[model samples]
Target: MIDYKPVSTPMSPKPKLSLTSGTLFDDPSKYRMVLGSLQYLSFTRPDIAYAVNKMSQFMHRPTDMHWQDAKQILRYLARTLSHGIYLRPNAPLALHAYSDADWTGDSDDMVSTNAYLIYLGSAPVSWSSKKQRGVACSSTEAEYRAVANTTAELRWLTSLLTELGVRLPTSPVVYCDNVGATYLCANLVFHSRMKHIALDYHFIREQVQSGELRVEHVSTKD
Candidate 1:
């Protein structure tokens, strides 16, 4: 839509994206092509990540509503053509990660969405927005899984930097908003209910004890 009016937001806050939200689009190929382009654009524009992840779920069988959302994202991109992420050359040489999850946010499935952002000093270096592989029994379980994903990324970054002969200013710290998940990572408590996630528990605990990473809680508002 060359002349389409620009929108302020990529997605509507009232109704979140769902696979069964609307009727099937007439031409799914066209929808796939547009969505593919948008996915490529998200490499630099993280603001549309959540919305893009939602739309990506319907790529196999996109509907008219999905197409509408894609158009809305286009409008948003149009409105902010000049906006871009700029990494500074003189930023500090430290690593930090922030992770968050939406518990069972999918309407069609009970799966959660896990998202994380990794920063080297002051600028973002890596980030992810993906649906969890399995259903979580509780919000804490979902949040904890997100932490594991972020921690894995942290380790990779650490090893890469070390190979380059780069020493970080401090140990990498991971921040999560869920108190229960944060405690699970930092504390040595082993409850019966946590047995299902024993592998994740051991993985993170090993990192904490070895001083490879640190997990802490942060206010959601932060």
Candidate 2:
């Protein structure tokens, strides 16, 4: 236990839903059925994510440790039964995103994680927090990749809104904390330093130049 410290969280209190796990592996007519329900609960409770992911790794074996984790998760739910995200239906719609990367923050693989979220009047309608698929030689490269992913999500959400008759302005603003990446998206200028990034990542540049998307810079959170 000393080798693995529990990750600390700074979350405040909130209301959540209650759920029950069926049983242990014995007399398990509905073990898989129960697992399906448990899987969906991950949508709201990020607290048990690490434990659930770890328990899933040993599904074929059904080890004592896995069942222990399941019961412990139930106990945790008993205590934290009132915590969740909430959004009201009457709020106005506003689509905007903030994109960023960790800049080689991963100790395991040295690949920085890309994080972004798009909001509709303060509620997060779309969000992603993922490690880059490939190594980036510079912070600029990682940031550019993050912005590309964010741009894709923005386009998809915009199209969905249009179909739903939720009218949006001409250009959606995507904020990036990297100036170099912002410039790259708005230009075809061949800087000797950034020639190594994939050509496909440059696709956002056309979108930027055409006034379909706008990239602005912001200061990173400390």
Top lDDT prediction, candidate number: 1
| Backbone clash tally (model 1) | 0
Task: Return the top candidate by TM-score.
Answer: 1
lDDT of 2: 0.68
lDDT at 204 for candidate 1? 88
TM-score of each: 0.94, 0.65
How would you encode candidate 2's per-residue C-alpha lDDT over 104-212 as one tens digit per residue? 7544357767777777776767666677888899898999999999999999998999999998755777899998888878766754578877777777888788878
Clashes of each: 0, 5
Give the Cα-based TM-score of candidate 1 against the true structure: 0.94
Q: What is the C-alpha RMSD of each candidate to the true structure, in Å?
A: 1.5, 8.5
lDDT of each: 0.88, 0.68
- The Cα error of candidate 2 at residue 151, in Å, is 0.6
